[model samples]
Target: MPSPVGHALGGAIAAVLIAPRGTPTGSGSRLMALRARLSHPLVRLGALAGCLPDADFLWGRHNMETHSVGAALAAALVAGLALRSRRAALVTGLAWLTHVAFDWLGSDDTPPLGVMALWPFDDRFVFAHAYLFEAISRRYWLPNFVTHNAWAVTSEVLMLAPILAVLVWWRQRGAGPRV
Candidate 1:
């Protein structure tokens, strides 16, 4: 899977794109006109969601069931219930799913490759095999591992920078007009 840096960056990028900055002129629905008042906090919260799936590592295994798309949706639903906002569900669920997507596209050199992304239903491990992201090596948390992760972080930043920029531009462009 890609580093948390990549996943959090992806979540930040998604937050900028999905968050409603302001109510557009003459918008009808209340939800459509919403300013997303707590958008700033939600932004950080959404980014945090990207890292939550890895919490599964504390229990038994990594990526077996926690990385599932169904799990992501369940998380979103729980987030909505907890926060009392559908928008919360939307942003968080998608952000969490982005982690799984990154893991899918990332390089995995260890045995029993890929994650059970479709768990509880299909129970099949899947991967993109395109290696758009470098796998994060946490097997060793030593100084050498820091250097190794540094390289991975550099690569991730280089690749994800443009997407983040585009999402920022998109958010700024849509901040005023919804048309």
Candidate 2:
């Protein structure tokens, strides 16, 4: 939600994974095509627009659902409806979900009320906000919303492999049309 890293990671995964599912014969090609579509200024603007509102409009106390999952889904759904691409919808959903998932693990609070991460299907929202960012001194506050948690250290040391792998696979699999 803060840096868009989680959203980008999730979008990449969903795009690559869904590409193959949508067109089994041309999985890579579909991925590339979708990537191109996603990269468009219109699509990027749309995604950012969807994501930025919560950060801009919402108040403090960590609006997890609106900031992460809710916003992402709203963006994806809008983009999907506007573009008429189910794949686009899928990718956007994944992006939003990914943002939520990351926050869940990084913190200790449960999700906010009525988050509806899987809206129209699931009614529950996650509300975990345990991570609190401190400066390098571990005493002072950072400029923006950077949280410090035990899991942050763990995430840096151990969990990075799978995350990196997923990222690498997403980008590589989504690149170029195969002959």
Candidate 3:
């Protein structure tokens, strides 16, 4: 499964694409606009949501209940009620689901491999077996731990940076206007 870094990037991307936008104001250079979007509370919340499913680790259940559509919907409902914005709710829920997506596409080295993505409706675990992202290691004492994780993080950055750049460019070119 992807690390928090990758998951956060995915969530931020979802937020940028789906969250409702305010009217563009001031100097609308790409950098400024991108900065503004990145700094929005919704983006930050999305990033948080992206990493939220990992909280299952605290209970020694990393890919169980929290990594499910049910959890995503609950998160959306709570965010919607709290923010009073349907767009925010949708963005937040999708952002949370991005965690599940990353995990589904990643390599899983643990037992009962894959995530319980459809929980509440079904308890079956699922995985794409795509291996698009590397599995993260919790074994700090392993010889290649640091090196492996570093490479994993680098790979994630390389994969995600281009997409983020394109999205920012599209927004700047008015192809994706703030809505």
TM-score of each: 0.82, 0.47, 0.92
- The deviation in Å at residue 170 for candidate 3 is 1.5
Model 1 lowest lDDT segment of ten? 30-39
- Which candidate achieves the best lDDT against the true structure? 3
Clashes of 2: 13
Over 140-168, each residue of candidate 2 has an lDDT whose tens digit, in order, gives 46543245534344344343336534543
What's the alpha carbon RMSD for model 2?
Answer: 7.8
Model 1, range 1-179, lDDT digits (tens) per residue? 77788888777766665666544456566544333322366667778888788888899778778888888899899989999987778878888888888888889987567778987887788988988887777869566787878899999999887876655555544663232
Pairs of residues clashing in candidate 1: none
- Preferred candidate (TM-score higher): 1 or 3: 3
Question: Could you tell me which 10 consecutive residues in candidate 3 have the lowest summed lDDT?
Answer: 18-27
Off by over 4 Å in 3: 21-23, 176-179
Model 3: how far is 98 from its true place, Å? Answer: 0.7
Q: List RMSD in Å for every model shown.
A: 5.9, 7.8, 1.9
